[model samples]
Target: MAKNSEKAVKKTTNKIVKSADNSGTKCLEDKNYKIENPLDEEYVNEVHVSDFMKALAYDPVKGVDTSNAEHISAWTDALPVRGTTSSTKNQKKPSKRKLREQEAAKPKGISHSLLQYPLIFMIGLIMFIELIAYISLRQIVRIWENVFSWRGKKRTLRNNLRASKTYKEWCESADALDNYMHKDEWKKTIPFAYYDYRLLQKVVKHLKMYRQGDTMEDATKLMDVLYVCLKQNFAGIENAKLYSNTYLGTKALIEEYVEEVTRSIEALASNKYISIEEKRLAFKLYSKNYGRTAFCLSGGAGFGYYHLGVIRALLDRGLLPSIITGTSAGSLMGAIVCSRTDEELDLILNPELSSRIRICQDNWPTKLYRLVTQGSLFDAEQWCREAMWFCKGSLTFKEAYERTGRIFNVSVIPYDPHSPPKLLNYITAPDCVVWSAVLASAAIPGILNPVVLMQKKRNSEHLIPYNYGHKFKDGSLSTDIPTLALNTQFNVNYTIVSQVNPHVHVFFYANQGSPGRPVTHLEGRGWRGGFLASTIEQMLKLDLAKWLKVLRSLKLLPTVNDQDWSSVWLQKFDGNVTILPKSDLSDWLHTIADPDADRLKKLMGSGQIRTWPKISMISNRMRIESCIEKVRRLLRTSPKSNRVGRFNSYSDAEIEKLSQHLEQHDTTNNYANNSDAGSGDELVFLSRRRVSMPDGSFQHLQDKDSIKEQNRRRKFMAQFLDSPKEGNNSTQSSVLFDSHSDDSDSHSPPPSSPEDYTHN
Candidate 1:
């Protein structure tokens, strides 16, 4: 058994030796010998056991069989054993030292491994760089698409804005953008920022379409968005001007949007909280567009004609100042004539004919002019009437005439150096005095009737009348006049009226000293006869009240009081009171009364009873009668020595001397009593001395203490009067005592009265 065991051990040893050699050869090939195979369990176990024994024995041994133990163990355990083949003679076994030397001879740096795969590393790096570039480009494209896509969806966006939810969302989104993004960023990110601004505008517009109640809040928010966007994106006027042209179409759209916005602003402007800046902005926009919009709808000619009527009414009511800067009366007349029809045009166009008749008869001159000139027609006549009504005929006929004359003079007639004298005269002749009287009469109805009645009944007529009989005779005086005729007529009339007539002649009767035959003596047959009659009648009927009201409303009336005409006289006549008589107090009274009978009556009845009448007529007969009564009263009051005897025949010099004395005395007294005198302290002092007041006492009492005491007493009296009385008994007692005291005072004059003194 021992011998058999020995053989087995020998065989196992040989196998183990062979396996070890094989393992060593594999290790030499791979270089990582520490990586063991799991399948070699017996070789691993044998190597481990050998390592353990060596460790236990503390042997510092080399070449221990730590490897191939699992293989060795497996071979020992296996039952079958194959017969070994004989080794080839040429295969020499390498010694362990030789193996170590061979392994050390192999190249061993990381560079060698890297060098093996150069192409793979390069390819991977290139791919990474390409990925980063593609990502950046993709993001840029996405942002671009988002910005430009807004334009295509603008319509859809607008339609969707009708929905309350969509509107709110839009506003919120816009607000968010405004808050988060810088203005520069918005300008860059939003393609055509102004175009995007239109979106908010659209939202506001649709919201506005809904009635006041439903969409007001939404509309307000949308408007705020628009304003903020505009303020942020386009702040300066230069930017606005540049953008206005660059994006003209967009600007036009904005203009339309502004029109709608203006209405909304106007509606809300009355709210106390709305800022004045907003209101001013709205008004600026409105004014900028108003003329253009009005022109577009009404036409330039129509606007001119409308303005003409306005001018005419303004002149009639005396609402306009004497000197108008921007607009001319000729422009106004041209505007009106331009609106006339061919037939109406022909009447004014006839060189031989007069314009007065045409003006009086033509109801649609202003309207026709507007139609002809502007190629547009509105209710121009109605507008004129309304404007006139508002102006209250503050425009006088004389003013209208002057304005009309100015229009003709400046605009109508061409200047000619070599023109015939007759032609010049014809062109220059403005029956202005005649036309003014006629126009004034026509413009104001209150002043028209009395003049007409006087012309028919009275012998004297002061104004020139138009031949209405001849004017309406042809029955061709309709509105179908040619535009050229009207234009030419306007030019010719203006030229003629503006010229200075060199051949003006004044004829005097042989009996120059005699009073001219009461104006009634010359009423026979020519142009003067009819003109005077119609003119006087027209003058009488001018109701200035309506015109005055209009002037008042327009704030054009002069600040002069009718009762205190002294200031006017003082300024105009250089302090001479003689001009007061020539001032035509009757005409002034007529002017005040014709338009305002009620006002005149109230003023006349206000204070003293005797001097002025509540209502007065402008008839020559009424004036003469009033003057006669005044003269009779003066005669009755005068001393017998100063009276003129009916039988006394006096020379011209004596009569003139008497008249001069009376005139001087009357003038001096009037000047002294003049209420319009300056109220300066110097004047007041002079006036007090003239009135014979005690100068020393008055001056002594004029101290601050006295003035203060006087004021306090006045205030106390006012308070006492204002306070309610206790009852009827207390009121009766107060009244009875006051009456009794007044009667007693009247019965006995004060001893120191100035009136009771006799001159020594």
Candidate 2:
């Protein structure tokens, strides 16, 4: 009976149901079973009022629409499945042949007919337009072809030459002419030397031989050849006078011509850099006989923008230095000036590139990380890469020197404080890589890691300055301004120091009348109290103070801060030209790591403006010197042959008279003086006080009869001189060389002497 009761209890307990009261859930009634016990009413009510139901009943905020169950279900049911579309359920694509047939069968209007053949019609119209253009503007096309097309111009010139019967016959006897010229013998004299000038001279001589026989057309062609040769070989040939049948004057008139040609050849021989404008100025200043100039650029971090302005001014004034010494940031500018030509420098220094090159911007955290780990705040490799890119190619120190004919020295100090600074240049380290040297020179201590040059390859130890282990730091620590370093290697007659350091006194001329005055009010800005700024400031101050003390010991430092101090100092130290930024631009000097490109450009412009007046003054002074030299040379020349010889009897009055004559004949195109006086043609100064020789010795005329004799001799020579007979003056000597002669000696001979022009 107990077991039966237990089974009935279990069945009854299973039948009991639990549900929320508000949900309206009804329990199913069964005839076979009945509930024994049920969940408590309070517990059921608590379950219904729980936090879970409250979360489901929560309403969202504005702009949020609650989902409609009915609508979502209905929309999902109506949506199409894969490979089926609801909008185009019954549509079918037409067959290709049927579509084509339909398109062809359509009735065509004027517009439809045109549309069918649109591409063809447009092409026909374009061709018609081109034909009309060709018919109407053929002459213009020909003119453009003749002027701009190299092949067309060359062909035209060649055809014109061929039109001359004598020239045509001359071309046929190339063998005979070659035999007479003996080019093989000449080539054996000076290997790798230029012979175009000599060959051109020979051609002129041949043309002179046929002067009576050749037609005017042939002669004009010969003149055209001469013009082409001059334009090609010489840098500044626009102002040159080419000889024709009417204007083949005496050899004296063409002495300058020969000299210019020879100078161009010499430029090639010596591997000196040359450009059109530079060569023009070179020709003008050929008589100056100036000594080698050394440019000493100081390290001032980004203040090197001032150096750019100085360089531009120097180049613009035609005072390119033969030696450049730089430290730290200045080394970068020095490398650029040494490795690249003026044209390349001009391109690199465009406003966009110049500004971008100054400072690199990086995050503070990244900078800190790099400073700790890499021993540098910035990626100096990027700077080097950009420098190499600007130069287009990498060159060794020796190669750069050979190509530019300018000595480049970069100052760098080793880790040892006791050791003196090493000047990395061609002479000191010939095989050192230029960009690497630049990197070593610019590597600032604490700020940048010392450039490590390891012996990566065998026999490549000499590729860098040091042989073994040595870390190179910034050049500023050893020598901030390496003025004396350059003088040690070369005879630096003139020193150009570009100083942008903020602590140094910027001594500039107050006016033309006053000598110079120090800009005492100028001071560094935005860098006070900073660790780097303060430390560097103190170091610079100490260095300068020591130098001042040394100068004082030598009695070269002036105590009085007055206008006369500059003159007195200059008198004591004659060859140094110091260019300083003015007080207004002092703010730029302290911005060592400036990131603004526009500010850098502005700073560079300021430097140019500050330097222009001084450069102009120097240029004028040099021009005056050149004029004096020219006059002296003319006075000393033998009247019969236009050769220089000692003439002690020549008086200063004759020299002064010649100067006056030169001033009268001075054309607007022949002279330029970039001075504040605003006269480009006024190069010759009349005042005795203004005109002083380079040696500081002034000359005055005393013997009146000697001046008359000089004039009379010149006149007498001009009246009685006669041109030489061409056949009697043939000096071409054929020196035979063995056929098995070494290829090393197969170079053209030296240029013909001045006497070679006597016959012509």
Question: Candidate 2 on 193-263: residue-level lDDT in tens?
Answer: 11223333443343333232344333322322222222211211111111101011111112223333333
Q: After superposing candidate 1, which stretches have Cα over 4 Å from the reference?
A: 1-259, 276-760
User: In each prediction, how many residue pairs overlap at the backbone (N, C-alpha, C within less than 3 A)?
Assistant: 69, 2
Model 2 scores a TM of 0.38
**TM values, all candidates:** 0.16, 0.38
Best by TM-score: 2
lDDT per residue for candidate 1 within 1-760, as digits (tens), equals: 2232334333432332232222111221232333222211221122222222222221111212332211111111133222211211222344586467555644466775455345335533553454454334434433543454234444244333222121123233322322232221222222232243334344344535521433434333322322222221111111121121110011223333333444443343332222333333322222211111000001111111222222222222222211111112222233333223223322222111111112223245654664555332332222223222211222222233333221221111111111111110112333322212222112211111111100111242222121110000000010011112212222100000100001100011111011111111121112222344334322322222123233333323222211111111111100000000111223333321121323222222221011011001011112222222223223323343312333124432354334543543432232223222213221222122111134412122345554464344334223211112211111110110112221111111111111111110
lDDT of 1: 0.23
By lDDT, who's the top model here? 2
